[model samples]
Every structure is written in structure tokens, then in C-alpha cells.
Target: MLDIQSLRRDLAGVAERLASRGFMLDKAEFSRLEIERKLLQTHTQTLQAQRNSSSKQIGAAKARGEDVSAIMAEIAGLGDALTAAETALQALQTELDALLMGIPNLPHESVAVGLSEDDNREISRVGLPRVFDFPVRDHVDLGEKFGLDFETASKIAGARFSLLRGDLARLHRALAQFMLDTHIVNHAYTEVYVPYLVNAESMRGTGQLPKFEDDLFHVPRKDMEKLYLIPTAEVPLTNIVREQIVPREQLPLKFVAHTPCFRSEAGAYGRDTRGMIRQHQFDKVELVQLVEPKDSYATLEALTAHAEAILQALQLPYRKMALCTRDLGFSAAKTYDLEVWLPAQNTYREISSCSNFEAFQTRRMLARFRGENGKPELLHSVNGSGLAVGRTLVAILENHQQADGSVVIPEVLRPYMGGLSALRPATD
Candidate 1:
């Protein structure tokens, strides 16, 4: 949430910045609402003052042993008017809050102004796509011999789902474990275990609700608040500091979690339906950090490197991209997407997205840290997928596949695979 004062000070300036990202500020409506709010607030205050004065007059009349009924009646009428005015003011404030909540975070100045992903600026590329001596196959074709079964998965859970058997399943698990271990051991992140189902407030704190509700999977209750299946570990990890005020000593709090993510994929019907590229459920190792506001931009670069460490360790060829204004996530002021090379697809696809929210989320969450003045200040939030386990697995299958359809395990993942050098077809 932006500081309301900023909007009041320069509505046009804020609107122009927002326009770069394709959001149109309703200036006229906001102005009308603001005018109404001021009038209602003044009227309410006036009535309150009148009632107080009338009560004092009634008290004086009683003390003098004289008639006080007129003053008493005036106080009663003022109380009724105050109640109505206060309610109107409250309703108008709620409307304004809703409008602000729906607005996306303002992009950082460094973010390029563009309309789509194609306009995103490339930062750097690492490693090189391996040369295949034989005809290459996509993950779907190459994974079948190793027990990648989608038909059974469909019978069990419908389309956009997958089931892996034998070593193929282990590879997926190994990827997640490898990512978790890497971030915990080398990246200075505290590991956490969190619930997969969260309340609506948690979703809203992370900028997922009240706007992108359709993209989430939720569970309705009989008489209680509905819970949502987290779309990423980022949701749980980042919300740890919700409504908290940490000491200055703990300037940076880093957290990591490996969890299964659920998404509805609403409005995305026929895209990437051929395989596990896009699924209803997938595993991920997420990284989150809370830091002092002044250090957030620097932390963003370091955090991006932390995620890049995983891809580099696995020897995956990937490129870092700075998302343009229009392509930025709803909560992120700035974002960097790591796209891993997929040999089968003959292209690079997003495997991780590192972002710095710059107090955008903390404002909504009331997440704060104590400053030198002993006052609370909003903390900046940063989070990214150390790596999406499913996409990493897909990249490995397509990048490391041998002519015989076997996959050579990346050296870093060997220990998790019980020292196995490669995955072979199941003999069954």
C-alpha cells in the first residue's frame, strides 16, 4: 500500500507512474470520495463537540437546580446525527481502501517501461546449451520410459496433473531437497516448515487476494472462514513478520521453505498442457528476506544471486531477466526472472523469480522494525524461488538426456540420489 499522504500530495504524479504499468488511476472518483470524507468527518466532529457542550450545559443547569430538559434533548439529537455521520465516513474509507488495495505496486524507476515480457531487459546468461548428437525429445517423450505416467495421473486427478514412478519420482524429490539444502547451508537462510493451507489475510498480505483470487485454489468451510492452498512457499515464509516489530539488530531476516504449491491456473486453459511445464500442483524451494528499507535494493541483487547459485550448481544454462513495468508481479516493485534452457523446447523458460517488494507488502502486513528513533518503520520484503523443482526436473531431463533416454544426474544432486550417477529406464 502506498502512503495515503503521497496520494494526497501528488495524485497526478502517482497516476503517471502507475500509468507506465498500465493502471489507470480514477482521479475524479478519488477526488469526489475525498471531498465527501472531509465533509462527513467535519460534520461528525461538529456534532460531537455540540453534544459535549450541551451535556456541560445540562450539568450546569442541574447543579443550579434549574430545567435541563432542552439541553438534554439537544444532546440526544446531536448523538444521533454523529452516529449516522460516523457510519458514512467509515463506509467511504472502506471504499477508498478497496481502491488502493486493487492498485498494483508502483514499479521502481530502474524498471523499463514496456507492455509485455518481450520488452524485459536481459541481464546475463550463464553456461551454454549442450549439443545433442542425436534427435532430442521433450520431457514427456523422454520421461515415459522412466515411469513418467500422465494417463494414470489424469484418471486419478484429471488433466494438468502428473504422476512419476520409480526413479523419475525420486529425481523430482531430489531436486527439491537439493535446493533446500543449498539455500539453508550456503545462502544463510533459516529453514522453516509451514502449513499448505492459509487464511485469506495471509493471502492478502502477500498480494494474492482481492485481485488475483481466481488464480488461487481455496477451501470453503461450513461456518468458518475459507482457507486457501498456498500458491507458493513465499506466501507463508514472507508472512512470518506480519504485525511484528523486530529490533534493529536483526536487520535482515532470511527464511527458506520447501513445499508443494497449488494453483488454479484460471484463464490459462490450453497453454503448456503437453507436460509438467504447467501443473495444478508443483514443488518449490522458496527464499524470503526482510530487511531495513535502505538496504533493500542491494539485497535484491544478492538475493537474485542466491537463486542463481542453484542453477549454476546444477550446471543449468540460464539467463537472468529484469522484468519490465507491465510484466512485474502485483506486489513486486522490481523482479528478476531466471529462465533455464530447455533443449526440447529449444528455448529458456522461467525457473525462478527474485523480487524486492520495497515495503509494498510490509505496509499491508504491518510488518515493521524499530529504528534509531525508537519508532517503528516498515520493512522491505524480498522473495524468490530458489528453484521450481518441477521446472528444474524438466530442464534436467531435456538437457542431460543420453541417446538411450537415460538422464545423467547433476553432480550436486548425486548424494541425494544415493550416489547414483544416472537415472535409467525402469525394468518393469
Candidate 2:
């Protein structure tokens, strides 16, 4: 939500900025509505004043034992007129607010204005893709050697699902635990356990509702209201402080949570339908930061680096891309996607996304902080996947495959795997 004063003062400039994100702001309608709002507001105030003065006159007439019927009739008519004006003012204000709610966040000046992901600029690269001497096998092939059974998973669930067995399943669990431990212990983030199911307001606070409703999985129980399977811990964790005014000392609140994310994949019927790359459910350790407005931009960069730390520690090759205006989401002023290299695909794939929502979400949630003068002001919100556990597992299997169809565990994950050095094929 933008400051209404900013919208009123710089309507033209604000409209143009929103246009870059494909939002059609009706300035003409907004201007007309603004005019109506002012006129109705003034009329209501004037009528209220008239009613107050008339009430005083009626009281004096009653005390003097004079004829009060004429004055009483005038008061009754003024009450009706005042009530109508107040109703009209409320309607106009509601219309104006609806228009504003549909508008996208204004892009930061540093964000490049472009139409699609092709326009995104690459910022940095880490590690290097490993060279294999033999015909390389993808994760699906390597994983099957150690009991990754898609057939069994499909039987239990449906498509876009997999069942890991033996050491493979343990590796998957270890990966999530390791990621959570790293984010909490080393990254200076408070470990949080958030609800995997959230209410509609939580979704709306993070700008996931009203526009992306079809992309979510909603579960409605008979006795309780509908709840959405959280697409990411970011939604639940960040909304914890929604509509709150935190003390200035807690300006930079860093939180990390691990949760199973569910996405409907409604429009993506046939894309990445292979393996675990695009699953109905996946584990991700999300990082969320609510900080002072002035510190958000720098915090975004630092948060991205923290995500890169996990990939670096695992020795994964990856690159960062700066999302252009068209590539940015409705809530993000700017975004960066970190794509990790998968040896099987022979290319990089998105494993994490980081974004700074520069007061866009804070305003909607009424999330604020006390300033030096003890006045409330909107805080900035940012969140990202430190790393998606499923994709990370895929990258490790494909990149660290051994000649004998075994998987060499990354040194960082060795402890988590109970000192296991390699994942060997079980003689079932």
C-alpha cells in the first residue's frame, strides 16, 4: 500500500511507474473520485456543524418554555441530510481504496525496466561446474540406485511426487536439518516454527491473495474457515508481526523457518514435470527480515549473500540474476533469483529467490515501528529461500555422482549424514 498522500500529490508520476509493471491505473477515474470524496466530506462536515447548532437552539427553546416543534422539525430534516452525506462519503472512499489496492508497488530506481526474464541482469557467479569423464546421469538416474522410487510415490500420492527409501530418504531429511541449523546458528537468524497452514489474511498480508489465488492449495474443514497450505514459510513467518508496532531497538528482526511448501502448479501443467524439480510439496528453509525502511536495500544484498553461503559451503556452482521490472513479482520492488548449476541438465536452475518489498507489504499489514519522535512509520520487509532442500539434493546427486553408481556426500553434509562418506547402492 502506498501513502495516499503520495498518490494524491504525484498521481501522474505514480501512474507511469505502475504502468511499467502492467498495472493500468485509471488516473481520470481516480481524479474524479478524489473530487467527489472532497465535496462529500465537506458537505458532511457542514451538515454536522448545522445539526450541532440546531440541537443547542432546541435545548434553549425547551428551557424557555417556547414552541419547539418548528425547531424540532428542522433538526429532523438536517439529521436525514447529514446521514445521507456521510453514506456517500464512505462509498467514495471505499471506491478510491479499491483502486489503490489493485495497483502494484512502484519499482525502485535501480531496478531495470524490462518486459521479461530475458532482460534480467546477471550479477555474480560462484564455484564451477564439475567435469565428468563418463556419460553423466541425472538425479533421477543416480537417485534410483539408492532407493528413490517415483513409482511407489505415485502409487501413494500422484504425479510430481517421489518416495525416498533407505539412505536416500535420510539424506533428504538431513539436508533440511542442515540448512535450518546453518541459518539459525551461523546466519544470526532466530529459529522459528511457523504454521504450515495459514489464514487468508496471512496470504493477503504477503501479497499472495486476490491475484494468485489459483496458484494455492486451500483446505476447508467443516467447523473451521478455509486455510491455505503455505507456499513458503515466508508467508507465515513474516506475517507474525503484521499490524504491529515494534520498538526501534528491534528494527532488524531476522527470522528463519523450515516448512513444507505446497503449490497447486495450476497453470504449469506440463513444465518440469520430471523428477523433483517441480513438486506439489517440497521442503525449504525460508529467511525473512523486517527492518527499518532505510536499511532494507542493504539487507536484501546481505540476505542474498547468506543464501549463497549455503551453496558455497556445499561447493555448488551458481549465478545471481537481477530481476527486471517485468520479471519482478507484484509485491517486490526488486528481486534476485539464485540459480544453481545442475550437472545433469548442463545448466543452472533456480534454487532460491530473494526480494526486498520496500514497505509494500508493511503498509498492507500496517506493520510499523516507533521512530525517534515516537511516531509510527511503515517498516520494510524482505524474504528468500536460503535454499530449497529438494533442489539442493538434486544438484548434489547429479554433480557428485561416483563411478560405481554411488553418491559422494558433500563434506558440509557429512556430519548431518551421521559420518557417512558416500551413498552406495543397497543390495535389495
Candidate 3:
């Protein structure tokens, strides 16, 4: 949520910034609401003061052995009006909160001012797309020879589901394991295991609810609050400090989690439906960091590099992109998307997104740390897919495919795969 003070102080300036991201600020509505709020609050305060003064007069009259009936009656009459005013003030604040919660975070000054993905700036490219003498196959075709079984997965679940058997399944698991180990050991992130299902408050803390509710898989229970299947481990890992104020020494808390993510893909219908590129359930190793506000932008670059390190270790060619203002995620003030090369598609596809949400998420979560002045201040949040396991698996299969329909395992992942070098077709 935006700082209400910022909005109150410069509604026009905030509105203009929001307009750059294509959000039309309802200036008239906000102004009208602000007026109503001020009036109700003032009226309530006046009534309260009158009640206090009249009660004091009533007390003095009683002490003097005089009838206090009139003074008492005056105080009594103010009671109903005060109650109504207070109620109105509460309702106005609620409305204001709802409006604030729905607004996207303002873009950082460094973010490029553009309207779409096409305008995103490419930061750098690493490695080179492999040259294949034989015909290139997408992950689906390459995995089919080994064990990518979609028909069976669909029967068990439905569309946007996948089942890997034999070596292919091992490769998928190995990718996730490799990512978790890399972040924990080399990147110095503490490994965490979090719940796959979370409450609505957790969702809202990460800026996933109230706006993207349709994109979530909600589980309704009898006489219990509805729970949501996590769309990414980012939601759980980042919310670990929600409503908390950490000590100053614990300024930068880096955490990583390998978890299965669920998404309804509400707005992604008919896109990337052919393979594991888009799935209802996918495994991902997520990275999250909580840091002092001033250091967040620097941490974002380092976080992006940590994710890039995974791709480098896997020997995959990829490019880093600075997302344009319009392409930025709802909670992120700035974002960098790492797109790995796909040999078959002849193009790069996003496998990870590193973002600096600044204090946008912390404000909503009330995640803070003690400052030098002995006051609690909001912490900035940074997170990314160290690598989306499923997509990374796809990239490896397509990028490392041999002429004989075999997929060579990346060297680093070999340890997790028990020194297995390649995935070959299984004989019946």
C-alpha cells in the first residue's frame, strides 16, 4: 500500500505517476472522499470535546450541591451524534484503504518510462545459443522419447498438468535440488521450507490479493477462512516477517525455498499451452530478501546476479531485461527478467524475474526493522525465481539435446542425478 501521507500531500503528482503505468487515478472520487473524511473526523472531535467539558461542569455542580440534570442531559444528547460521527469516520477510512490497496506501486525514478514489453531494455546477454546439426526439438518432443507423459498427467489432473517418468522426472527433481543448494551454499541464503497453502492475509501482504484474486486457487472450508494455494514460494518466504519488527542487527534476511507453485492462469489462457512452459502446478526455487530501505536497489542487482549464476552454472544462454514501467509487476517498483534461450523456439523465454519491491510490500505487511533513532521503519523486499524449476528443465532439455534424441545433463546437476550424464530413451 502507498503511504497515505504521500497521497494526501501530493495527490496530483501521485496520480500523474500512476497514469504513466496506465492506471487512471480517480482524482474526483479521492478528493470527495478526503473531504468527507475530514468533515466527519472534525465533527467527531468537536462532539467529544463538548462531552468532556459538560461532564466537568456536571461534576462541579454536584460538588456544590446543585442539580446537574441539565448538564447531564446536554452530555447525553451529544452521545448519539458522537457515535454516528465516529461510525462514519470508520467507514470513510475503510473506503480510503480499499482504494489505496488497489493502486499499483509507483515506478522508481530509474525505471524506464514505456508502455510494454517491447520497450524493456536489455541489460546483457550471457553465453551463446547452442548450434544443433540435427533438427531442434522443443522440450515436449525431446522429453517424450525419455518420459514426458502429458496424456497420463491430464488424466490424473487436467490440462496444464504434466507427469514426468523415469529419467525425465529425475532431471526435473535434480534441477530444483541444484537451485536450492546453489542459493543456500554459494549465495548465502538460508534455506526455508514453507506451507504450500496460505491465508488471504499472507496473499495480501505480498500484493497478490484484492486485485489478482482470480489468478489464485482458493480452498474454501466449512466455518474457516478461505486459504489459497501459493502461486510461488515468494509469497510465503517474503511474508515470514509480516507484522513483525526485526532487530537492527537482522537487517538483511535472505531466504530461499524450493516449493511447488500453483496458479490458475486466469488471464493466460491459450498461451504456452503446449508444454511445461505454462502449468497449473510447477516447482520453483524462490529467493527473497528483506533489507534496509537504502540498500534495496543494490540488493536487487545482486539478487538478479544470483539468479543469473544459476543459468551460468547450467551453461544456458540467457539475457537480462529491465522491465519497462508498464511491464513491471504490481508490487515491484523495478524488475529484471532473465530470459533463457530456447533452441527450438529460436528465441529467449523468461525463466526468472528479479524485483525490488522497495517498501511497497513491507507497507502492506507491516514488516519493519528498528532504525538508528529507535523507531521502527519499513524494510524493502526483494525476490526472484532463483530459477523456475519447470522452465529450467525445459531449457535444459531443448538446449542440451543430442542427435540421438538424448538430453545431456548439465555438469552441476550431475551430482544430484547420481552422476548421470544424459537422459536417453527407455526400452520397453
Candidate 4:
């Protein structure tokens, strides 16, 4: 949530910044609520003061042997009025909070000003797309030979599901394991195992609830709060510090986790429906960091490099993109998307997104660290998909595919694959 004080200071400026991200702030409603809140609060305070004054007079009159019935009655009326005003004030405050919660984070000054993905700036491109000797096949076509079964998956579940068997299934697992080990060893992130299902507060802390609830899958409980399936490991990893005040010594906390993420894909109907590019269930090795404000931007770059290391190690061609203001995620002040080259698609597809949320998420979580002045201060959060495992598998299959229908495994993953260097179909 945005600092209400900032809005109070300059609602128009805040509104303009949000407009760049396509959110129209209802300033009139906010102003009305603010005015009403102030009036009610002042009236409540006045009532309390009057009640106290009357009570004092009643006591003094009793001591003087004078009737205090009128003063007592006046105080009783003031007390009732105060109760009503306080209740109304609380309700208005709740309304203001809901409005603030729905607002997206303001883009950082460094973020590019644009209106869509087209306006995103390319930071760098790594490796060249391989020259193919024959027709390039998408992951769906190549995967069918090695046991990628969408038909069986749909029969058992529904659409947008996939079941991998044999070498393809093993390769999928290897990708996630490799990414996890790489982050833990190379990037020095503490490996974590978190619940795939989290509470609503956990969702809200990570900016996933209330607004994007439609994009989530939830498990209903009888007479209990429903739990939400995390859309990314980023939720649990980042929320580890929720409602916490870390010791100053632990200024920065880095975490990595490999987990199966579930999303409803509510708004992405008919998009990437052919293969593993978009799935209701996908595996991702997520990286999250909580750091002091001064180090957040620097941490973002380092975190992005940590994700890039996996692609570079696998010899996959990819590019880094700086998302425009309009393309930034709800809670991210700035973001970098790493799009891996897909030969079959003849384009780069997002395989990872590294973001610096600044204090946007921490503020919502009330995740804080002690400052130099020994005061609790909000920590800045950074997170990224070290690599989406399914997409990484897709990239490897397409980029390293051979004319003979065999896929060459990267050297880094050979050990994880029991020294095997390539995946070939059983028919081969």
C-alpha cells in the first residue's frame, strides 16, 4: 500500500505517476473520505473532552452538595455520540485502506516511460540463435516423441495441463534441481522449503490478494479460512519476513526455493495454450532478497545476474529487457525480464522476471529492519524466477534439438542426469 502521508502531501502527483501505469485514482472520493474522517475524528475528540469536563463538574458539584443529574446526563449523551463517531471513523479508515491496497506501486524514476511491452527497452542480448539444418519444431512437436502427453493430462484433469514421462519427465526434474543447486551454491542464497498453500495474509503481503484473487486458485475449508495456492514461490519466500523486524546485522536476507506454482490463468485464455509455455501447474526456482533501501537496486542487478548464470551455463541464448512503467508488476517499482530465445517460435520468450519492489511489498507486509537510528524501517524486496523449469526445458528442447530428434543436454546438467549428455526417444 502507498504511504497515505504521501498521498496527503501530493495526491495529484501520485495520481499522475499511477496514470503512467494505467491506474486512474479517484481523487474526489479520497478527498471526501479524508474530509469526513477528519470531521468525525475531531467531533469524537470534542465529545470525549466535553464528557471529561462534565464528569469533573459533576464530581465538584457533588462535593458542594449540589444536584449533578443534568451534568451526568450531558456526559452520558456525549459518550454515546463519541461511540458513534469512532465507529464511523473506523469504517471510513477501512474504506481508505481498501482503495490504497488496490493501487499499484509508482514506477521508479529510472523506469522507462511507455504504455506496453513494445515500449520495453532491451538491455542486452546473449548468445546467438543456433542455425538449424531443418525445420525448427516447437516444444510440443519435439516433446511428443519423448513422452510429453497433453491428451492423457486433459483426460485426467483438463486443458492447460501436461504429463511428462520417460526422459522428458527426468529432464524437467533435472532443470529444477539444477537451477536450485546453482542458486544455492553460486549465488549464496539460502535454500528454503515453503508451503505451496498459504494463508490470505500471506497472499496479501506479497500483493497477490484482494486485487488479483481471480488469478489465483484457493482451497475452501469448512468453517475455516480458505488457503490460496501460491502463484509463485516468490510469495512464501518474500513473505518469510512478513510482520517481522530483522536485527540490523541481518540487513539482507536471501532465499531460494523450487516449487510447483499454480495459477488460474484467468486473463490469459487462449495464450500459449499449445505447450508448457503457460500451464496451470509449472515448476520454478524462485529467488528472493530483503535488503536495506540503499542496496535494493544493486541487489536487483546481482539477482538478475544470478538468474542469467543458469541460462549462460546451459548455453541458452537469451536477452534482458527493462519493463516499461506500464508493464511493471503491481508491486514492483522496477523489473527486468529475461527472455530466452526459442528457435521454434522465432522469438524470445520470458523465462524469468527479476524485480526490485523497493518498499512496496515490505510496506504491505510490515517487514522491517532496524535502521542506523535504531528505528524500525521498511525493508526493500527483490525477487525473480531463477528460471521457470518448464520453460527452461522448452528452451533446451528447441535450442539444442538435433535433426535426428535427439536433444543435447548442457554440460552443467550432465551430472544431474547421471553423466548423460543427451536425451533421445525410446524409438531412437
lDDT of each: 0.92, 0.90, 0.93, 0.93
Stretch of 10 with least lDDT, candidate 4: 71-80
Error of 1 at 89 (Å): 0.9
lDDT of 3 at 272: 92
Q: How well is each residue in 1-428 modelled by candidate 1, as lDDT tens digits?
A: 87777888899999999999989999888888888888988888888788788778888889999998777765666766788988998999999899889888899999999999999999999999999999999999989988888999999999989999978899899998988888888888999999999999999899998899999999999999999999999889888999999888987999999999999999989899899999999999999999999999999999999999999999899999999999998888999999999998899999999999998899999999999899999999998999999999999999999998788999999999999999887656
Instruction: Kindly indicate the candidate among 2 and 3 with the higher lDDT.
Output: 3
Distance from true position, residue 183, model 1, in Å? 0.9
Cα lDDT, model 1, residue 17: 90
Query: Which lDDT tens digits does candidate 4 get at residues 186-255?
Result: 7899999999999999999999977999999999999999999999999999899999999979768999
- The digit string of per-residue lDDT tens for model 2 on 1-428 reads 77778889999999899888778789999899998999999999999899888888988999999999998886777877888999999988898877777677888999998988889999998888888888899999899888888899999999988788888888988888888888888889999999999999998889888678999999999999899999999898889889899999976999999899999999899999889999998999999999998899999999999999999988889999998888888889989999999988889999999999999888888899998788998899999999999999999898889888888998888898899999987766
Q: How close is candidate 4 to the true structure, as a TM-score?
A: 0.95
Given candidate 3, what's the lDDT at residue 186? 93
Report the candidate with higher TM-score, 3 versus 4: 3
